[model samples]
Target: MRIAAGLIAVVAVAVVSSSVPPEPRRAAAQETAVTAGATVETEPVAHSGDAADDPAIWFDPTDAARSLVIGADKKGALETYDLTGKRIQRIPDVYPNNVDVRGNVVVAADDDTDEGVLRIYLVDPTTRQLTSAATVPTRVTAHGLCLYRSPKTDKLYAFPNSVSGRVEQWELTVRGTVVTAKSVRLFTLGRAVEGCVADDASGALYIGEEKVGIWRYGAEPDAGRSRTMVDGARPEREGHLQADVEGLAIAGDRLYASSQGSSDYTVYGRMDNKYLGRFRVVNSGGVDGCQDTDGIEASSRPLGTAFPAGVFICQDGYNLRGTTVERQNFKLIPLDRVVLPIGTLPIPYP
Candidate 1:
C-alpha cells in the first residue's frame, strides 16, 4: 500500500508537469537578451507630430560646429534644427516623406499636393537655412529619396521610389541658382520599397524592401535589374535581418539599415553587402531607447566636438519622457560609438 501510494503520487506530478505548455518552458530556458550599444537622443522636434520621418545632416562648409540637421515631418513641413537640437527654420505647407543632401542642394520627396515631385532647396551655408529653389515633378508618387553623385561621370542624380514599387533615377542639373530634374532610368523591386542610399565612390545602391529584406544594385541607370539579396529577415537563420528593413545609410565603408520588425539596426559591408552585425539604440544618459525607426542618415565626415568622427542619425518611432508621450524625434549616435563594439573604425575618404 505504501509503494502504490508513492507510485501514484509520482505519476500525478508527472501528469501535471506535462499538462503545462512546453512552449513557455522552452522560451524561458532558450530566450536570451540581446546587447547593443547605447545612443544619445537629441531634443525633441518643435511640431509634435507622429510624422517625424527622416533626417539629413548638412554640414557647414565654413563652420563645422554650426552644422544643421534637417528633418522631414511627413505630415506638414521640412524642419531644420541646429546641432544643439534647436528648431531654427521650418518650411510649411509641404509634406516631405524623405529628404537627402547632395552638395548645396536639399532634395525631398514631396507628397503634399497632387504634384508628385521632388522639392529642391538650396542650403544657405551662412545662415544654415534652406531657401526655396525649385520643384521637379517625378510623375510617380515619391515615397523615399536619395541623392547620388556619380564618381564615374561626375553627374548628380536623385533616386526616388514610389509606394507602388516604382523606382526612378533622375538626373539633376543646376542652371544658375535653379534646379531641375530629368528622368534617366526606371526599375522596380516588386513590393513596397523605401529607404535607399547610394555609395557614389563604389557606384552601388542599397535599398530596403519593407516586407522582404535588403538588396544591393548598381547605381548606373542602365545597370539592368540585376540585384543581389544582401540579407533576408529570417528569424531562424543566424545574423538574418528581421522583417521591414526600413532605412539605409552609409557610414564610411559600412551600411546601417533599420530593421523595424526587430526594433534594431543591422550593419553590412558597403562594397560586398556582407552581413556584419546588429545593434539597437538603448536608453542612455537620460534619453529613452529607440523603437521601430524609419529613416536614418549617416556621415563619415566629422562634425565638430558633438560628432568628432561623424554621426549616425535615426528616426525614433517612440519619443517618451516620464509619463508623457512626446512627439517622434531623431536620435544622434556618434559613428565611432556605434562601431566600437564591432571593432570597425571609420576609413578615410579617398
Candidate 2:
C-alpha cells in the first residue's frame, strides 16, 4: 500500500513539473535550468513600504566580525545585519529590492523608481554599516543582484537581472571604496527574467523568470556574447511556482526557489523542474501576514559533525498587514528545521 502511495506522489510532482505548453512552446524545446539555507527567528528589520524583499549572505569564517548578511526592506531604506541576527543601521535613501554581496562589498538593485540604477555599498561588516560606493546606470528596472566569478577568465562579475529582458554581467574592480566597472556583458533572454544566482566554483549562472519559469546560461566570456547554452526550462504555469518567484539558492546539488502566491517554496536538485518537496512560511508576529514570499538565500546550518550545514533565510514581501505602507523584513529558518530531504547533495547547486 505504501509503495502505491509513493508512486502516486511521484506521479503528482511529475505531472505538475511537466505541465508546460505543447509545441514551439514546449518546455523541452526551451533551455533547461541546472542550478542552484537556514536561519533563526528574528524580528526582521522593518521598512517603510515592504518589510523584507531580498537577502545576500557573505561568509568569512576567518573573520567572523567581517562576515555579514544584508537585506532590503524596500520602503526607502536598506539594512545591515550580522549573522547572529542583530540590526546595524538603516541606509537612508536606497530604494533597492534585491541584495547580493561579495567580500566586504554588497550590491543592491533599486526598483520602484524609474532611475534604472545599481546602488553599491562600501560595507564594514564588523560594524554593520555601509556607505555609498557609486551609482551605475542600469538600462531598466533592476530586480535581482548577484556576484559571479568567471571560470574561464577568472574575472569577477556583478550581474543584475532587469525588466528590460536582458541580463547584464559586468566585470568588477574596486580600489578602496571606488568601483570601476568594465567588460559589461548583456545577455538577452527571450523575455524579462528575474531572480538570478551565480556559482563561482563552476562558472555557471541560473536565471528565474517571473512570467516564465527558470532558464540556465553557461556564461563563458565568449559564450555570453550569444544566446546558445540555455536549456530545457518551461515557462511557469499560472498557479504553481508562478507567483513572483524572486529568489534562488543552492545546497549540495539541489536548487531551491520560492513561489509568492502560495506562500510556499519548491526545490529542484537537478537541472530540470522536478519538485522534490514543498514547504510554506508560518507566520508568528512575523511579517508574512502582510507580504507573500520574496527573496531567499542559503548557507550551511551547522548542527554537528553528523549533519551537513543547514540554515536558510527568506525575505518578506509586505509589512503591517499589506494594508498600510511599510518596509519588508527578513526571516530566518533552518532547512532541516523546515523540511525533510529525500537525498543529501554532494555540493549545493548543481
Query: Residue 308 in candidate 1 has what lDDT?
Result: 85
Model 1 reaches what TM-score against the true structure? Answer: 0.86
lDDT of 2 by residue, 1-350 (tens): 01221121101111222221111111121222111122333345654434567787766445543445577766676876665567766787777778887666778887666745678878764555688888777756677777776656766677777766677776778889788776466777757666777776565677776666656676555555433222223244533364455687765556677655444566665444455655544443423321256788876534332223555677755333322423446666645544435455456431
Top TM-score hit:
1
Model 2, stretches more than 4 Å misplaced? 1-39, 63-66, 112-115, 225-240, 270-274, 283-291, 301-308, 318-327, 338-345, 348-350
Count the clashes in each prediction.
0, 35
Model 2 poorest ten-residue lDDT run: 5-14
Error of 1 at 198 (Å): 0.5
Candidate 1 weakest lDDT stretch, 10 residues: 20-29
